[model samples]
Target chain A: MKRLKLFPISRRAKDLLAGKLMLLLTILAALLVLLMVAGLYLKSRPVLASQPLAELLFSTKWRPFRGQFGFFPFIMGTLWVTGVAVLIAVPLCLLTAIYLSEYAPARVREWVKPLIDILAGIPSVVFGVWGMLVVVPFIKDSVAPFFKVFSTGYSILAGGIVLAIMIFPVIIHVALEVFRAVPQEVREASLAVGATRWQTVKHVVLRKALPGVAAAIVLGIARAFGETMAVLMVVGNVAKVPGNVLDPAYPLPALIANNYGEMLSIPLYDSALMLAALILLLVILLFNLLSRAVLARVERSIR
Target chain B: MDRRKVEEGIFRVLMVLATGLILSSLVMILLTVLVKGLPYLSLEMVTQTPRGGYYLGKGGGILNAIIGSLYLAGGATLLAILFSLPVALYLNVYSRPDARFVSVCRLAFDVLNGVPSIVFGAFGFTLMIYFGLRASLLGGIIAIALLILPMLIRAMDEVIRLVPRELMDASYALGATRWETALRVVTRQALPGILTAVLIAFGRGIGDAAAVIFTAGFTDAVPTSLLRPAATLPLAIFFQLGVPVPEVQGRAYASALILTLLILIISVAARRLSRRLTRHVVK
Candidate 1:
């Protein structure tokens, strides 16, 4: 009000405001990223400081109470559970995506897609509850009996099955997108070669969509690794490294979920959880970067 | 030919089974929760504060938790929208084309999107405690706002970019100022899409429990104030009934079902509304 200037919207003011907003957002993002890095660093220092890094890296036990903190068990547990999940999910998800994209009538795809979308919208805790009551029991009574040679009770198998169910939609959504992105000529050319419908999908469509499929798989792995509630509820929460797929074992995220709230506000425990979080963040970030790279490669290859 | 037909038939069956299993999991979860918790879902559960064991049924109701969820999520959504919208607008308008600033913002948004919720919770806990807020709803709202801000900005930027450039030209040709044109014409026409972005972010915030868990420490007796601790449905599921009690477990299932239904309904509605608006604009 004090200024009746001819050009109130000065160039300097515009640039200044833009610079200030950019600085604010950058600082916030930087702080969040730094906290994650620092938190992990502080948390993992004990293990990192100990001698014989080889043993720590290769050891199967994760007895932090006695200060024997080998991450192999946790890492293996995560991979095994998620691998089994991917094994169960990938085929089913691909099939569903194919059915939706290719086989299903338009109206049917429309109906199914929204349901899948809504399924994704449901909270993870609800899935956890469902896993606890329904999935765990099914595993306990049905699958465990068949797998008694390896494990007679709740195991990674149960957790993996539940996780597969949880992540199926993500795979389907991404795969469907990739399938749709494949060019029409490829499909027609493959069909012109007298390939059956399945052959066209298997050879032409899926091969063309391989890069996207890889991205989707990596994304599914990322989601599975960070997931907490459902796995914690069904995995039996054992802290041991499993010798077989049927054995109960803990993953890093589940450990944090179960122990973070209970641990006294001590630096060691806080750092431990933070270290676990750091590991999770790093794994997820690495894969995210990998997917971006894959997408970039796909763009390049296409061009 | 017969062999190929048989193989195709088998593949079709497997496809149906795959779809069936996914659908069944969804149905099974919903049906199990509804069957177990439906009878217990009374007006009191929705209206009053939670008491002791759900069986004893002596507590007030879930009204406080519901209100806390609404306020925390609503406040977070508002802040995210408030900050991100303008920032997105500025980035769209002021930043030189292909500038380092724009790329940096894009990278930050990507990192934010990929940063896990638990990590966000830990950061919030440390930073809020450092500020002496201890665990409160404001802290939770702030944490969620951070989590949703990147997504909000990206969505808003997309919708804003979709705003036709001819409109900008028209306004400028009329001797309207830069601010006036942006505020009056472009924004007014882009309002629906922006609202859609806000709704999507709000829905995402509402369903999020990890970001809220550490920032808003769980409280049993309804949140009397923003400074006070509060229980959300997701937190309640994680904390209260995570044990082996039947009644408590029942209550948790009921709460989970309710929370899931609310989020799903709102998210679906928001997404459909946004899609409709975009389609209308395009037409």
Candidate 2:
């Protein structure tokens, strides 16, 4: 009997040991983000020390061989592409989400959900290939000419259009979830009060889902900001701030990707590129944190 | 009242149009790839490595890239599963539901999931320099593994969290220790979800180009060792498209088609496997 009791204690000890092992692994996994931030910062310190942060961020000069690294144009390029993408994607995705959630039949919703998943699953490189073969030609041949502007088809608009398409599935998926999360009774109550379907969607459903919708948009923007290969392929990598949507502009990711191989040849070039990556990481981190905070608040309020 | 009705009609039409537009674009993308790729895709293109002046529209296939991608992503997935399973299990089983540490870890994973693949590439390159490692298959695996780690863990966590609590209680009632309950009962119950998460991470890893471009330097031959430079299908497409040769460009489309088909198969398999595995599931 005493031996049997000791058996249970030994089993308990084994359980405790297992728990401690898992805890250590979990902590190591969680510390990866901190490791990435610290590594990038330390590598970028040379450029950060040589130039003032404001000058590095705000200056327009970018002579890599001469050791000058102004990132203002790339920053602006990122903003322009992401801004245009958001402007194009949000309305279309929101409308699509509304249709799927409120208007489409259950069968149709089931069919379309998988389609959106397919869209999301399509690789970015494939999208770049399509953008190059189709969107760029269309822009150069039709859209730009119609707008009375000349573009080589590689411009901020091309990047934005491709990016908008890439982000459509992301926004639509999230927005559909948000819309579906609205209690069925809430919709019934509005309808019972003689509210039109559109009215309920515009007023009550939208109101209840406003935070989620905002979170979706923020997520899309974050995606647009950091996309590398597709945008790099389409956005003509001119090292100047784009004056209009049709102008070719270089974004930061492209700068890092295109020049990383050759950066070792030039002084502070690697540092500058690392700093670009650091900035990208910081911005994306901020956007993600903000969206999470917004989501958490809504979840708490709902509870 | 009439104006409101008109407004409703207009918005309804707008919604339908927007949805139609999105659907049409999907169709367009698929058609573009199929139409452009079919003519160039041959059995040889899948069988042989690139020969002399392949970029010049000469005789050769992308077997190197196809094989290399499989190796890189497959190795990375295995590596990620090693870390992801333990972390995910810990988050769902070893901690309290409302534990502060658990929430913080969840939040960290969420943020990490949003970090772009390019950042991983850049960071991996930094590590490579520090460790005096060259761009090789091993480097690519490490980079892609990190890129997919958070995604893998979060996906598994979501699935493991959905396992019925009562099932765990029953395990405990049977005199199973917490570790036994977690490993045997919880994991068995969540097997379908765990498999789905693993496949999703594998798909993401294989499809990703930004994370592997710098870490996996292009090579004509298949990777023979972990330290050798490797080619991937996405980079193959990118490089081939950059060439001004029309035939080379056509091969790029073919490569994209191959990659797309691989992803489609994996996704289909994941759905089918999960559905089949749920036979013993309680609900």
Q: Against the true structure, whose TM-score is highest?
A: 2
Model number with the top DockQ: 2
Task: State each model's CA lDDT, in order.
Answer: 0.74, 0.92
Instruction: Report how closely model 2 matches the true complex, as a DockQ value.
Output: 0.77
Candidate 1: misplaced stretches above 4 Å? A1-35, A42-68, A149-153, A265-267, A299-303, B2-9, B52-58, B96-104, B169-187, B275-283
Per-residue error at B280 for model 1, in Å?
7.3
> Lowest-lDDT window of 10 residues in candidate 2 chain B?
B197-206
Best model per lDDT: 2
lDDT of 1 by residue, A199-262 (tens): 7888888898899889888878888887777777778777777887778878877777666565
Docking level of model 2: medium
Residue-level lDDT tens digits of model 2 in A32-120: 98889999999999999998999999999999888889999999999999998999999999999999999999998888888888888
TM-scores for all predictions: 0.89, 0.98
Clashing pairs in 2: none
Each model's DockQ score: 0.44, 0.77
